[model samples]
Target: MQFTFALFAAAALLTPVYSNEITPMSRRETGIKLESCTTSQQAVVEAAVQRAASLAKAAADAAINGDASIFEDGKVTYNCGNGTTQSDCGGNGVLAYALSGNNKIVNCPSWYKIVPAIDDCGGTDQGLAMVHELSHMNEVYSPPTQDFAYKYNDLVQLPTEQAVLNADTYNLYAGAIDLGCQVGESKGVVLPDWMVTEIMNNNSK
Candidate 1:
């Protein structure tokens, strides 16, 4: 049993997270507010938003050039059943999204909705997913396009403990780092400063 558990742990360490994620999407109508969502959901989203807000300013400052209204027009939505929203993105691994047509700063969308995984609601999973999706929103100004795992190999493990920061996409390092920071701040699951910096600065956008 000991050997078996050790083998599993080692395998888990090597395997990069491919999917089972969350993201934000756009909404036209009044949807689930942060207050209305489950407790776990709220905790996760709030933490993500807090950290994202912090990063928004610092990140923009880092570039020495960015938009002012980034992460300002954000909202929340709850997705259940198999087919929800445009991507149906409702599953165990492919959990959520912060949907946008393209990775452009100027043509930003009006309403960035932080969609939720309802089935995962009412528990720790909800909070985790909320943070995951918010990290997706961190890309509101500049949606990622490069696969983050290629750049930051431990991306799947470093950032958060609640949910896996799906590193399957071509780009998501920023969101993952945001997720990690939020998780650490809110849940006391902090990572090393160097790792956090590497995740944020390497493949942000």
Candidate 2:
């Protein structure tokens, strides 16, 4: 249940963002790269990487392309599509899971580029989408699909699964809060009520 949404989801919210602080990711090697996109979009991605530094670094090390000793081993590449229908960004972001490895790509869709969309509970659609996909790049949960991020969804909390679920919940809410707060400041849009509620609920916990 990876909830998919367009750029419109990262909505404007001036609320208190984080209630539950995210434990910092134990950083890893920067084995990831970005292959396509304009210089401007590339800059946007650089900013995104800086904002999500730990997750980005984790994504890098999680890839073991060929032999561990090889320089190009386990390298993951992301291409910023032009937010078109026929894009690798696959409606904001795409996570590919394979027998060999997993790949994540995000389309850098600007706030203005998105058509006027009605926000429901998804003010941080693009931001959350990006975070969700990047989080999956770590492969800690080993969910069958690359898209199954446990956000507002149930995960069976068996003893073996409880720890993973707890971690997932933290990351999901932390990113949600981050994206929610940034939306209003950067995107200049009003946060949907649902988004505010969601943020408040998470913060309360």
Candidate 3:
């Protein structure tokens, strides 16, 4: 009996034990890495990333699932600093940006807002900004086009094909889901019928 017990103990000791620490679903699925951020900044980023993931998942559960699938969730490193002497963030009122085909997201100094619980449709916040950058990742869309509009007003007027390819369209769709409001109701801008239908379908679900 003692030999049997010793054998069991030896076997248990030799078994490999795995860690219980589980990575967040958002970080795991999106491959988002936060670098060189303060504690508060990290908190803001975490919230925004979580919100963006939630928005993406919600969109995936609707008729616009194809749009949500475009995110790709590729590896992206986010930094809280002015990009290379403020080249992208200097004077154009840009909040955050990712260079075409780049795996990095640089947040301009002005991009310090926390993810807001949007109360109205057509409103933008940090989470939407993250969504925009995710769309710009090369893994998500190659040869990212900069000609498409990012502003809500202009986005509503873009052709359906062009709008689908624009980063801001994802932002707006995600934003609308976050707010639980329809884009047309808030801005009085008539989006393409397909977009309106998709938004309504998402909201209804």
Candidate 4:
């Protein structure tokens, strides 16, 4: 149920020009390494990782003076493989995953898009999905937990304590900032500025 937006030009005009108040994290800073993926896939991975890092940085800046406490060190290796053979592939609509103890590695399916479009707040793209995976890495969240609040609906209703830990919360927060809109706008569950403010407020408390 992925929604595609063919409004890149319109989106570009709507996308905010993020300031340099806090330097955004780069792919190198994130330490994301791709294996067994095509050159085009690698490029998409790079973009996705960079996007996640920048969004994470933005969240940190807005929440706690650019303190990226969860992103301790972005050292994760991504391996592309067939969905059928890989564990956690295509389960419950999951796009990627990090094994329990081997949190340094993320398994992505071969069918994973090389260049997924920028998602509206209602839907997810590869970039947003990768952000969800990043949140599971030990380097991102120490003692990485398995309880990720999935989908837009769960993200909005998440309690403060759970919202701070849920991977999808981070994804939606990033998406909210990237799209400059409320979460679930397309799904008709609009909460004005909820994603941007709620998580930051929770972190502040």
Question: What's each prediction's TM-score?
Answer: 0.33, 0.40, 0.71, 0.67
lDDT of each: 0.30, 0.35, 0.57, 0.52
lDDT of 2 by residue, 48-120 (tens): 4444433222222221111122223224455665443434334433322122144545454442253222233
* Model 2 segments more than 4 A misplaced: 1-30, 54-74, 82-102, 108-127, 138-171, 176-205
Candidate 2 residue 25 C-alpha distance from true site, Å: 16
lDDT by residue (tens digit), candidate 3, 37-101 = 87777777777776665555544444333332233333567786633344557565677878645
User: Residues 1-205, candidate 1, lDDT per residue (tens digit)?
Assistant: 0001111111121112111232332122112233334455445544434333333323233322233333222233333222233344443344445443421111011112333222211122332333334334323312222223322334434444211333231123223333444324554334335434544553363
Compute the lDDT of residue 160 as modeled in candidate 2.
26
Off by over 4 Å in 4: 1-29, 68-74, 82-92, 143-145, 183-189, 192-205
Best by TM-score: 3
| Candidate 4 lDDT by residue in tens digits, 153-201 | 7666866656656667666655665665544456344643544455546
Minimum summed lDDT over a 10-residue window in model 4 is located at 1-10
Per-structure clash totals for the candidates: 12, 13, 0, 0
Model 1: lDDT of residue 14: 14
